[model samples]
Target: MESLLLSHSAFIPSQNKEVGYLGRKLQSSFYGNMVSNNFALRSNINSANRSVMISSVFGIGRKVKKVKKETVIPEPDYRIPIVLLGWSGGLIYADNLAAAVPIGLLGLLLLVQTTRVRFVFDDEALEVKVGEQLEESGENVFVGGKNRWKYSSFVNWELWWPNFPILVYFKETQTRPEGQVHFFPVIFNGKQLYDVMVERCGPSKTSAPKES
Candidate 1:
């Protein structure tokens, strides 16, 4: 569950998808609070729009221990969060808002840097842009990487906490199984991305047009 609900959260994307950082921040902020369990998500989309509705958070940034003086991207502020949004699913194509902010002032305090988020859906894989501030502890570093996954490799999924967060785990593969997983959140409106997963996964493969 959310540590505390706040109405005044940062990271709101505009209608044209100009804003960035907020959605990714929200995902990272709520990621740790995730729990492991199985639960079904109800579909809220009607017949008129068969397209799936989801808020994809593409995270960008990596953790650097000691904050070395030399690096890429100049004068980066490890204080503010950055987020960018791109929405897509079936027949639905529109920019969407984010859900509740993670814990409390903690998110504000913890956001040393922000991530970039984008959403991609094709016949091969469901790609959502996701990078991390790269968890750092002055000594070790934890990178926020691997924001893409194949539905075929999808082993199972679980709802994080109270409302929209979801934890999707993948099976052990060539380079995966090193605890490879991604965290995604659903936008408000009584809908869940799990429904999209149920509808999009597996079928997208068979539905692909075959080459002659």
Candidate 2:
């Protein structure tokens, strides 16, 4: 078997001074009705941006304190995640005959959320330190087994809304998440990175698992 070294890193979006202001406006608008009476709404945007910026700049990770063990597998899946940004909302009406009203005014809020995708190798797992804001606050490391997508850890799983990305409800026992990771606007996408990861970790397993 051939041995290869892989790194756990994410592509950070380019820094923009306008991002902070733009984010605040959009988030305030979405929860306009929900948080109309709440004065602390503005603070939410600043806090969210602060966390999101740090995560994106550094990528979802922590220091590699030590290498417990490393091994290379035969196959790996290399799907590049696309980062969506610049959130916007639109209004629409949903008609339900079963409900009290035949035509109800429904504000269909369309928002763009930012994210980054990095390929994880079968033998490659990351030891991450999550902030107290997240469920797994302590120092944690996820190990990759024969299945690459079956990871043991994830960070900052949040719901991307118009202005701010909100953290979804997480239980202490639930292992898998229903949301995606928060990322910065600075995105790094090159054919070289994609090809390298895919070549190193291509999926050819006979059976597909339930979770990734």
Please name the candidate that would achieve the greatest TM-score relative to the true structure.
1
**Span of ten consecutive residues with least summed lDDT in model 1:** 82-91
Q: What is the Cα-based lDDT of residue 7 in candidate 1?
A: 25
Off by over 4 Å in 1: 1-116, 130-145, 161-174, 177-179, 184-192, 202-212
lDDT of 1: 0.35
Compared with the true structure, the alpha-carbon lDDT of candidate 2 equals: 0.31
RMSD of 2: 41.1
In the order shown, what is each candidate's alpha-carbon RMSD? 42.1, 41.1
**Residue 25's C-alpha lDDT in candidate 1?**
67
In the predicted model 2, the residue pairs found to clash are 12-186, 13-185, 13-186, 13-187, 14-186, 27-163, 76-201, 76-202, 87-112
Structural similarity to truth (TM-score) of each candidate: 0.29, 0.17
lDDT of 2 by residue, 131-182 (tens): 2321222322242222123233432222222122222211121234553332
Candidate 1: residue 19 lDDT (0-100)? 33
